[model samples]
Target: MEFKPDWEQAVRRFEAWYAFEETDRPVMIVSAPKAPRQDPPAPGDLLRRWTDAEYLIARHEAAFRSTHYAGESYPHCWPNLGPGIAGAYAGCEPVFDETTMWLKPLDRPLSGIHPVWDEDNHWWQVTLELTHAAAEAGEGRWVTGITDLGGVTDILAGMRHSDRLCIEMLEEPEEILRVRDGLLEIWKRAYSALADITQPVNGGTTGWLGAFSVHRTYPLQCDFCCMIGPEMFERFVLPELRELCRWLDRSVYHLDGPGAVKHLDALLGIRELNAIQWVQGAGQAPTIEWADLLKRILDAGKSVFAYASPQEVRPLLERLGARGVALAVGASTPEEADYLVRMSAEWSRP
Candidate 1:
């Protein structure tokens, strides 16, 4: 079945901000806690729901319906298995359950290190199949694609343990490059396949009567390189990141946590990067603590994705000009969402 997208306006608006173009209004979203959903749906369930007119409503609200243990508490239906799905085809096996997925090593500290590319690999096959399922299920919903994978270091760390990866940097430097380059090839290939999948709906591609033209965009991510310092990131992660960025229309770095903040210099310096999704970590002062970081990102001439309390909305607007900030707030109903949207729009403009 042909992939379909019902939120072209939302997509274009997001792409515009992702590309750092000044938009007419900021995308003010109501970021709410997942009010317990009964019989939480999977990708297949979503597809089934999308086919039914009533189900489409549920599919559209899939984000709020999904549950996650940790990390970006967004919808789980996006199917972000890992960047090493391609690498898995080369010998790695991915483990998937109801909640999340991860790649499993073949043997002791990297035994089955084969440079193969088979769609039959556990991770690769599952993702490929899910793409079809989503295309079918997403009949008239939001687009579905894998997360924008970071370069080799990121993939390896994910496939292999971080401690093992640190050892590999010394013990198996050559293998590291082989794995890195191999994963790069695979990352690009997987994304290209997804690109083909979303092309009918303009998923990873750009161009929609906008003032700014994005050479490449969609499949947004930057989870890798954020954990390490700038030096480590430069030597191990940046090269592949550069490669990934060159392929997309507008690439935004998902700067996750204060640990990843060290790479902020490298991220801001990269010309190809369009914006930064500052994922403020949990605990006290999350939305408020990152005020300076937001300013720095803006100073670097990039956009930001932030979530604030409804009460904090006024101060947030006063502090950060809304030219490039996308708000994810929690509103009770469409009326409330509309009110906040209008308020944000008014504050953001002048």
Candidate 2:
């Protein structure tokens, strides 16, 4: 590992975390900027900013050069075309804005909507090009991750708007399955294709979540499940998630927000699902607010990961007891990163 000289040690730590065991300390990923960050004026075209391969690669390279990755943290460059890029690959219209990008909804009946994988889709090509360029620049320095092709049902919700998909799931349940079945195929094809490109260069694989593994692993998700009940979730989302978990060597479900907690039990039921990344979402800052929830996931027999602050790490470890707990956090200085790594041994349960 070029950027990570101590990668083998980190791998040992990660393996313990995945198996619900503690190494010398619970896994804590910490990073600090090598120097203070400054901003330059932005270009007017959001589309070019998102699509330009050289620009994207150089930007990641700059960040890699400017950040001190410590503890379990490592340099990872993931193609972030927002979460709905999968819908774009299925030929859905994309609307670019200043902060993010989204797919323009079709909002038509399921019977009329037939989504297929377009091998030559514009955004699809952009994502591939971006991955290749990032890998070239980051080959020995940083790791390149596959783009977020997104979860199948979420792609359907993006393709047909969440409101319309909610209606279709009830009024035309079978048709809902019909369309999602198609999207599921597209999801597999897209993931497999990107994995083929990333694996050889990355020496394994990583995702937007920054969790790295020597074998195939992904942060599986279906944010749309927050809209439906358990019955609907099990019917529409669970089967696809099961297939993904079975297919991949390892997986962690990205359980985001209050709305998503409802599906936790259903997700936990998947035998192959390795862990859960619990996000407290907006206004839920200072992750310690969710100690009970974090403990619940650990009790359910899966390793847990969350974003916390340096201040929250010790208390979180205290409350959760650190057995299967991992926290990804930011520090302000190289000294702070070193401090956290040393203090984590104190934070972990004996």
Candidate 3:
């Protein structure tokens, strides 16, 4: 282990609550991994997103500590694999390496409307390896699960050109659904396998939380809603998502950027959801611009899991309160992490 956790009791307490067992520990903070801005950037602006084993470990370690520190906080972190893993099951190709994995389309969706998966697929094997390794590393610190939805909708765009998918929405709606359904079937199997391989923190128990047990928290996700109108999402995308959510536990919907705000209502309507992790999406909003949106979600009676800097805490506590807010901040030393924790506790206590 790269970092030997100093908070073992905290870790056990979190594991208990995460499995939905009652615990006497008090809650203080939330656990989440910071999304690192990739370096040596992807060549050509092809919208490349990548994840490596080391990065995944870092995220898991951070999440374990955050959940441990909070005592009663949710222990959540993703398998953090590459974006194209899901599409590869649908017959696309993903490039893999030590640091990150990426996907480049071999054929357009219209060329082969159907998708296929086998025992030796590159992305599938790589993702499975990374997921297994992450679970081993968790070591009772926190529950580890797979990363993003493998860019589900975006990969569809990459496989079948976005324009083609748009046209297919009308020309071949059934074909689009077939491909989407196939991708989802693979996701369900992956999640089930992951969930089965990893059991409840108490070791395989069936209950309220077990039914929602996820080996990984952020398994399937997409930001494509930012590009399409709400009408398109409601008709083409929403039902597929509803079907997908039914199979897993503790989903945290990723609200990417302001443009995707329109779909928030649709996401909220899904009763199985545990919380919404809102990414204000860079620039000035990381400071204060997101406060309004945070308040809106809290007002809707949903728990909010988001990153907040020390500077943003006062206004955030004033507006959204601390009962259901999760904060992620960068602290260079133990002293700083301690100070921030103390400040957050004071603000959270009524």
List the candidates' TM-scores in order. Answer: 0.77, 0.95, 0.73
lDDT of each: 0.58, 0.83, 0.56
TM-score order, best first, reads 2, 1, 3
Error of 2 at 129 (Å): 0.8
Alpha-carbon runs more than 4 Å astray in model 3: 1-79, 96-101, 109-111, 137-143, 147-151, 200-216
lDDT of 3 at 11: 44
Q: Which tens-of-lDDT digit does each residue in 20-134 have in candidate 3?
A: 3332322234332333423333333222233355555665564445322322233544565555567776667666665565556545445376665555766667666666676
How does candidate 1 fare on TM-score?
0.77
* Distance from true location, Cα of 62 in model 1, Å: 6.7
Show where candidate 1 strays beyond 4 Å.
1-8, 31-77, 80-87, 106-112, 147-151, 202-227
Task: Give lDDT tens digits, candidate 1, residues 1-350.
Answer: 11222244555566667656776666564533335555435446532332333343355455434322111112223444444445455566656554444667545545456455666666566566656665555544444444434445655776777767877776777777777777777767777776567556434443111112223554334455555556667776777777767777676666777778878888788787777777767763767667888888988888887777777766676677677777677655545555666677666666
Better of 1 and 2 by lDDT: 2
Off by over 4 Å in 2: 38-44
Candidate 2 on 1-350: residue-level lDDT in tens?
76678877876777777777756788889999987554333455778777777767767766776788789998888888888688888878888776677789885657888878889988888888998888877777778998877888888888888888898888998998888888887877888888888888877888888777778888989998888899999888998899999998879999999999988888888888889999988877569989898989889889999998899988898888767778998999988997988888887765
lDDT of 3 at 264: 87
State candidate 3's TM-score.
0.73
